[model samples]
Target: MGRKINFIVLTGLVLVCLLLGTEYQYLETAQGIDSGDTAWMIVASAFVLLMTPGLAFFYGGMVTKKSVISTMLQSFVALGVISVLWVVVGFSLAFGDSVYGIIGNPFTYFNFNNVTVSPNPAFSETIPFLIFALFQLKFAIITPALITGSFAERIRFRSYILFMVLFSLFIYSPLAHMTWHPDGLLRKLGVLDFAGGTVVHMSAGIAALAGAIYLGKRKEPIERPANIPFVILGTGLLWFGWFGFNAGSALGANTDAVIAFANTNLASAASMITWIFFDRMQHRKMSALGACIGAIVGLVAITPAAGFVTIGQSVFIGFVAAVVSNLAIRWHERTEIDDTLDVFPSHGVGGMVGMLLTGVFAKDVGLVYGETKTFIYHLLALCVVAVVTFFGSLLLYKITDLLLRMRVREDQEHRGLDASQHGEHLL
Candidate 1:
């Protein structure tokens, strides 16, 4: 009886195995690959890519006409330089394996090996990893471009090139590594800069402050800004491109991206209305220029928190940010900082506000969604980043000056960077 039972069981096992093999083959034949996620990332990358030119115009219009083209060109040129560097080494350093809580290791992956479409395991499982690196390159390109506005029309172009090359390898790459990488020092420390508040704005802002101080004041008080109409056009592009900046940060075509998109608009609209009121209250008039500036300020402040906060919360945050940033810019004018184009006030101060505000408003804190920090964590992160970036940039400026004796000559400042550096004049 025992032998007969064993024989029946062995026969049944063989038949079950055969059925399982047939089903596996059928499933494979029925299903195919999906590319929806890939398409989204490509479109998102293109949108973020245009922001550099938009930035050129934004910073350019704020300078004297003679230096306007030069300021704008600086932004334009960085795009070409950073784009190549990004594909070659910048991406590897940013997304590579973390080394004792410092920078990344670059030897791994198809990166720098002259191969296209090497997959990264870091960003998202569904999206092609190359898409991940490309999206971030856009952010890296714009951060330093934004800083050019601070030292616009004054710094020598040759010095500027050296500064950018070093800035990308040393300053930008390491900060991005620490902030965004899964194993970065700041990320492990629980700093949540969703869309580059610390990495892009805080770093750029503090860097701008250091450059403003190191370069010394402009030869004359920034000739009361030229071309208000041009300023208006640039502001429009800034507002439009900012949608890509905040929304594409979602990285997926899902509900989170939609919420981020909506919040961006809410914050900017609220900022505009509130700023107009503030101007009317203080100066007894409503100015178009003030409204445009206020809207941009609001846009900057909401960036870090756009995907994390509510629409109502964004409205309040935007209003307060505009008021505070406006006050800061005015205060800066009174001081000796002389931040040309107000880069420090608008992007720097506004970003700081958004970073801290993200802590107050960041909603979910599930294991998958990442750690949820209260306000204290955000403040601590902000303080550490601000101090480090300020000193880091100051040291860089001193080193460059010591070696090359950089910074534009006084006569060049009087003549403008456009005429002196580029040998062209703005219309």
Candidate 2:
């Protein structure tokens, strides 16, 4: 009876918060809202939202049947968890009034307070501020979901949830604030991330490495993927959604969006071809898995430079990133650390390659344009992000472990996370 009462009270409190957010209004009027830009942004936001489900299939098809359900759930659950957190506080911490150029003042937009239907010049001058906030929310959702692949099949579901919350609060919000906020430290320093090479992919990839190390190796031997068809299907969806992911960052239906859209497809194609070629050289056969991974590496590599570089430069970035990530995966295999899906090699290395290449190839400000200042700033920002994400992730993992044991027991692992953790089975 007491437990039921507590649950009721908690539910009531949540309802009240929602009510307050809905009734709230900002009286400020935005100038020159464009219908075309608004329409494009709405579609783009939906496109970005779809990537989480696409990622579910991408990781789901790679794990054993016994863990398939659990693996996919990690990505699916983030849509719900992060979405609510974003409306409540995550958005404020990321884009609210800037505090010392490091983070947003959480109270400025708490529970969606003052997030107006009219445009905010700080983010987008032509779209509703609410729409811009929602668009950014999708990016936040996927960033943590990206980490699940590293610890799949071994993480306790409850502990994983707790860790996701912590990671979102401590690691993701600050990075997003520092990179995307108008007055952010990195932004002020002239460190350019056209999409999210550093903020999303690099942070997720490095955290994946930390999670894999902290959890140690899985006791069970790695097995062949249960379903390649799912992987292919996922790859297709991710590729489709990426158009919005890259182009939508432009915040308008403009030339930059068009350029980003074209560059996205070009880079992905080049990377896929290069990856298969490498496979043919090493194994004498092209592979579907190789093609999909190569395509994803290309997408990841081009994300940061999508709007800044030309189609030709994007192709070059894709090819180079594929080569580097493929080698990183090979090197990772030899190490004692077990990163289940090679998230770090593919995302971490790919994002780094994109960031560096952006400094070299970006229009007007690139090293190729005889400007070294932008390149030097990018290098400095890369080191800062890499160091902060690494140590911060390591600390978060430790704290999560202390509060809730991160690893499942041996018997639970043998039974698999789906059946043991959630009482479900894939096959």
Candidate 3:
């Protein structure tokens, strides 16, 4: 049955690609394109793409040795799955014509029909619209990859692929539309997400929580990181790629990008330092794992405010977010909910902190600047996003499970997902 289903899907995808082949002829570079900006954006897109494999390492190293291969593949597969999906209809569903400010018309840029090399002034005037779409594609890819951590080691690989597609289409695209699109509901309401604190990190984190809850506990919930060194390597790659993640959102080689770059570094540094010291204060050892997690939390917290807040404010945001998320992890340990790798504590809570602080410290519009409206809107948007992502993800998980069982069999769980699901194991 699974083989038949895979064959049918593959056949349909091939037909769709053939039908869309003519659309590629429309691709042409337009005048008024800035070479420098275009170069930077291309590099930025590549940098963002690298983060996915980096994520694979980051996640793989955190799971037990028996599950390492399966865990890493979960993140790695998104590169193939989401890239194709985005080109097919995911990009349109995100950046296409706004449909009532909540979603995009799927036909607006169907199969890259009008997504040409010409700059779309609405997105970025200096770079090709195709580049813009691809840049956003990287974000779409990573969001679902991030969720795999919550259910790692026990999820059936095929079931997860289905869930990833559903999550990207239903959850990720709409949120991207509502947060980043010019006609987006939240954007019009004065919400300021310079990067993806809300759209990517928050949505992934919240959805991760739903997944962990829906999937329940792994049969063996014990965690013994497979390789701490891989965690360090992944952290380094993520930190390096994040400059593009935050600064590239500026859409140009401009002052805002420079400011964002500086803020990104400062926040991560402060959070890393704060996290280790905070552990010391609690009589815990300052392990390298903690440092890596702390740096990531800082990155998540700083994302939304990177281009909007001052350097000093970014550091403060990182400091506050690290302490809060560290506390969140400790609190989570008390619950029966098993979120492998603590995705909710790190990305979810960190994103929330960043979103709220962006409201407080955003230039000229923050609470500290005496403007109440933006801050109020941010609070409201945060609630809306949380409710939408959590419940929506729960629904998607249910639907996916109904279509195909989501979890592995008990024996398979005991044997580890790498060998059971993929028929392969790490050396």
Candidate 4:
């Protein structure tokens, strides 16, 4: 979910409600100190922002040196591309007032009619709406960027630009509504993703699969990572930013936020150690890349449950999610599919694990307003979304491949995509 969940996302919008579900004239009415939560949110926002660059480094390092510049360019591609789209249309299409449980109506495109800075009725209605829009925009920006890695070495720049537009406008917007909007199908089914397990991470992972299949594999899919150190850098920066990703979901400086922050740290630590221990036992030496991957798995696992579960529960969630994703990725390697970054097994499988565990581990964490049969609903929702996302992704990949000759030609692939597609050399 490392797009995380709605815990903070939901809490930050409750303009008319109080801590105890009391009708409140002012969310800041109590101590009048929005200082702590507001300050934390400010920091959390930065953390989340940093993750995008971190992702660029992570993905870029995995591509062949010849394609390094092209790979890194995708991050730039997302930064420039999604930012404008979010402001002009993407925001309204997602968070706009619902239109019968479909896409959100464009109630405020181009900041149309000057949408007020009023707080949403969902959180505390204290944080400004602009803040909400920007926060979610950060999410929107990073997601399509995530998919770029799968197709990194071969996709035509023009085709990718077109795909990005359609993805944000058609695919991302409605899906966001389907889960985040009040009447959304997932929400209506009692699904509780505090952030974006299904909406962002799962969806991106699926789309990554689609993009990979459509763009086809790298000219040489077997090329080792260009810089393992860069992978470590990617892992480090991502782990650091995740604090914001999970904790910021609370959107305020509260106990829930603190719980999220701590869980993010702990789960990653546990996962890193577990992967090192398990892999070292199987092989002779521990691998830095494996540990970093383990840490990422930990981050993905705790995303849905960061605010919902106890610390002890967090350890369990991280462990289980890592182990499952690890096994799944190994299984994936034996197949014909060439996911350059293994986004599906890692993010997709890990996200499913996180979302389902959220159902199982959600507790009466005295912080949030309502806490119910936490785990079961999460599990069911995870299964349903996984099925939909997986099948939907497969169809899209097939259709796109059929129409566009998704994969690079074998001759070009043998020559390396950077040279084959771009008429340039790596250096």
Report the number of the highest-lDDT candidate: 3
Model 1 vs. true fold: TM: 0.87
Whole-model lDDT for model 4 versus the true structure?
Answer: 0.72
Q: How well does each candidate superpose onto the true structure, as a TM-score?
A: 0.87, 0.96, 0.98, 0.83
Q: Write model 3 residue lDDT over 133-194, tens digit each, in one string.
A: 99999999999999999999889999999999999999999999999999999999999999
Model 2 lDDT tens row, 300-337: 99999999999899999999999999999999999998
- Stretches > 4 Å off in candidate 4: 1-36, 108-114, 215-219, 365-376, 394-427
TM-score pick, better of 1 and 4: 1
Per-residue C-alpha lDDT of model 1 across residues 1-427, encoded as one tens digit per residue: 4345346646755664453343212122212212665677778788777778878877776778788888888888888778766765787787777887667776543233421253344666556566777888899898889889888878887677657766787788888998888899888877777677778887888899889998988777665677677677877877887777788788777677788888889999988898889878887578777888788888888888888888998998898888888888879989988788888998889889888777777776422246555566778888988888889888888876765556778888888888888888766
User: Candidate 2: misplaced stretches above 4 Å?
Assistant: 1-22, 26-31
Model 1, total clashes: 0
lDDT of 4 at 21: 49
Residue 256 error, candidate 3, Å: 0.7
Q: Residue 398 error for model 2, in Å?
A: 0.9
Q: Which model scores highest in TM-score?
A: 3
Clashing pairs in 2: none
Model 1: residues with Cα > 4 Å off, grouped in runs: 1-34, 109-111, 114-119, 365-373
- Candidate 4 per-residue lDDT, tens place, 4-60, comes to 322443553353123224332333333333656656766777888888888888887
Report the lDDT of model 3 for residue 75: 94
Order of all candidates by TM-score, from best down to worst? 3, 2, 1, 4
